[model samples]
Target: MASLFQRRRNKATQVERVRERRHEGFLRYAGFRWAKISASLCLLVIVSYALVDVTPRHNGGSWYGYTLGTIGAGLILWLTALGYRKRKMTSDHWSLKAWTSAHVYLGLSLIVIGTWHTGFQLGWNVHTLAWALMMLVILSGLYGVVVYATLPAALSNNRDEMTQMQMLEAIRAFDRQLHTAAQPLTPEDTAPVLAALDEDPFAGGIGARLSGRYPDCATAAAHRALSASRSSDAEAREKVVGLLSQKQAALGRLRQHLRIRALLEIWLYVHVPLTFALIAALSAHIVSVFFYW
Candidate 1:
């Protein structure tokens, strides 16, 4: 019976070992090789552009320069297509992470090829506009990358697994506690607290939301009022003050959440509008090149 049991255990362990090896092999081929190929291709493009010199003629466009520029522009457009195509592809087939890795490296390759295509010329033309827009888009995308990489961890820590709703609710609960604590205050003492509660938290217009500077925020006003008020009952005043302090802390957390969320969202405003402008500029550039020259 002991020998039988030992034999079963050995077989189970061997099967597990085989599965582990297979998993590692799959990851090696699919994961590492994908990154390796992307890196190698990007290097090849960069090196080729660096080694080749196709300076533009002074009077007219050189056929060689035109060809290089066309190829480079085609690659840029192709890279853009890859971004959209990768979005549509299944994760099992090609992971979004791998696609993004390829996108970043290949996008970097464009800078080398694009500069070579330009021959380092800048002018007030559609060509220049297109190039400027492309740079803007690339820079904004880089901003997004940085924000995603760094802020997400900070956001998670700030949230502590709580949703935004939960955070707001916590703030409101603290406010309720403050309200109860403030009840014992004389009419004169309670006047500011009442005024604070009367003001709207979300009444600020679009400008205030975008600026993130809410001068009329009830929480801030209440803090100031609590600081300035003079009361005879030291112990009661201290208790009320402590509650106000807790409410202020909770309000700070809520505001931090709003600030971070706003920062994350604000970039999209620049990025999306610029992307549309780039598309239009690129179209105009292609049309002007073919029509005039």
Candidate 2:
């Protein structure tokens, strides 16, 4: 019995390792388990919407509409809970990964549930506002998903195993070399080298960071100015120019890193605020339905 138990435990451990390797992404979680469930749900809603007949045709005022509305509202509330779920870390049946998978797939099903609840009757009202907000939230979420899936690898590759501080250090080292190399040059040539040394790597604002374009880069300007020197101290000018070129290359890599990071995070600025607006609009919609309508 002891030997049998040991064998079973070893087999369980091997199986678990395989499972860990296979279940790497939330999109493919449980063999797309949530996706299959969500698809079935959408199909059911679509089929029921077509088959079930209501007096004066289906509309938000009908019993069927109210039922669909309740389901949709419930789903919205649950999906919103995902923000809270992220606060706690767990690896159980309802793990964060599992919750996120469900959030994405089930949240997508709202398009069917919400539209069917309206019975295709849309207008200029809080109901329509709520629907629009939900769609915006979903679209923003899709954008976040796409960036998260694709940009992380690019970010890692661009980093080249160096931390941000290390990149800055490299530029600083080039500046030190430029300072020493400029000592023998004339004042006119040294002025540009000094400007490059004093230039801030992070001088540009958010616009420049996101775009990765530094039109006013002092390093580049200095390199250009020094490169064109026809002065007597040709060797000293060349050394300064070379250091400036290396500094510019370092700055480019750093800016590229900033741009990728900005792309990854900017979506949250749109997504989180819209989620709050959606909840507010959704609340007003529910209250109006029960009390006023």
Candidate 3:
């Protein structure tokens, strides 16, 4: 019975190790403690909004509005400080994970706070513009949460245990094979092969990265050309065609990997820039409200 118990413990440890290896990530960190906090904060703000009865149509100038506004503004500053918090590494309780967990939850809470600050009254003013930008930033952060949770799995599956450098190296090896194999082909057939070899793998920029659709893939063109040309000479065409197929398949995996990675990371480009923009718009909103006051 003791031996059986030990074996079960060992098996459980092995399973846990395997799970850790795949690595889902931080969005669901600590059993979604942050998500719960965010939900509760939102609920509290919303409940308070419904319960508190204010005059002058319940706008931003109210006392409760000022309280919510104070909290929201402080939240915006604190959430933005995550950029700075991330730069310094720490090992104790105030680790990056703790900071990020707080960032996500508290950032989410701001949605309620900011909305309540307006007393659910929106207008065509700098205040509304700031709120819009803040919403955009938060939406982008939520996108980050989604991609972070899901894309890592897809990325791992696509990689098949290969590293980024290894993927690039595999492409290089395929190119070399394609080049050597294509040398004997006729000039017309060789045009597409040369184009395939000559084209930069990283050429397509943001559109290609995002879409993962390389319509003008020289390797694909060469494969199509060679597939047709296979009728001319069975053996030689087969070799070149096979190599092109290999190259195309490898490129597809690479592109898929890149696309997943880009999806995982691309939200930051939207989130960070808009964070600054939100802060600036928020500053303008505050200044306009006070300057007019």
Candidate 4:
């Protein structure tokens, strides 16, 4: 009986430990294990690059350069495996969080590995092109890391305890109220209300979403025009204007939410394509090296 109780308690403690590790952020995974490893790798490469006496100085064709190139190429392929790794699940050391931590740090280490591979000998060739593409991919990845780390809090605060669907419903409710309130107004006054109702909440495209600017938004225009009205049914106009104002505020919050999401996701649009391009350039580079030799 005592043995059974001890076994159950140990099992419960193990489950709790797994739960705590699961909630920890990837950057701090295993207490920055990947960061330390990547830094050490870079330091070793830099020291080797400085100490090794490559005959006729260093260039991509040198023996030392070949070693760095091999390391960089392998690292790139491993880093790219992260996309596939995301589809798999595990709770041990090779979990998704650990894979991501390694991906980020190792990816950054390419700056050192790749630059040393070139041996400071850049030019207008496929070799240079591969290096440039790699740099671009890294820069975009860095942007992705920054936004993921910082913008999520802003996104949560903007949500204000409302689901996206709820926010849209709130806008629609205001629109219904505006429609009923405008019924007593003249045709001229009703025109703006109609325009506001007709406007699409998401019509501005990617640029507008990212910028959070809708200079020609019909709802905003309607609100302004109705607020300035001197019609005899001023009370009705005021009511419609008030509804428009509420709808406008709702739209602002929705757009702000979208802007943050866009910023969060736009890097992938750049990063993924550039990564493929880098691979192609890298392939070409390797082939040319062997072909010329």
Which residue pairs overlap in candidate 3's backbone? none
Candidate 2 wrongly placed segments (more than 4 Å): 1-23
Error of 1 at 58 (Å): 9.2
Q: Name the TM-score of candidate 1.
A: 0.76
Deviation of model 4 at 286, angstroms: 0.3
Candidate 4, poorest ten consecutive residues by summed lDDT:
230-239
Q: Per-residue lDDT tens digits of candidate 1, residues 24-97?
A: 43224345665476467557655764666555431114554476567667766765665477558565545565
Candidate 3 RMSD to the real structure: 3.7
The total number of steric clashes, by the backbone 3 Å criterion, in model 3 comes to: 0
Error of 3 at 107 (Å): 1.4
Candidate 3 lDDT, tens digit per residue, 1-293?
A: 99999999999999997687335345555677778888988898888888989875667888888788878998899888888998999945567777787788888788888887887778898999999998899899989877877787899999999988888898899888878887777887888889999878877888999999998888888889888874345677789889888878888898999899889888888899999999999999888878876
Number of the candidate with higher lDDT, 2 or 3: 2
Candidate 3 residue runs with Cα over 4 Å from true position: 1-25, 230-232
Give Cα distance to truth, residue 94, candidate 1, Å: 2.4
The true-versus-predicted C-alpha distance at residue 171 of model 1, in Å, is 1.6
Give all candidates' CA lDDT scores: 0.67, 0.90, 0.84, 0.92
Candidate structures ordered by TM-score, highest first: 4, 2, 3, 1
- Highest TM-score among the candidates is held by which one? 4
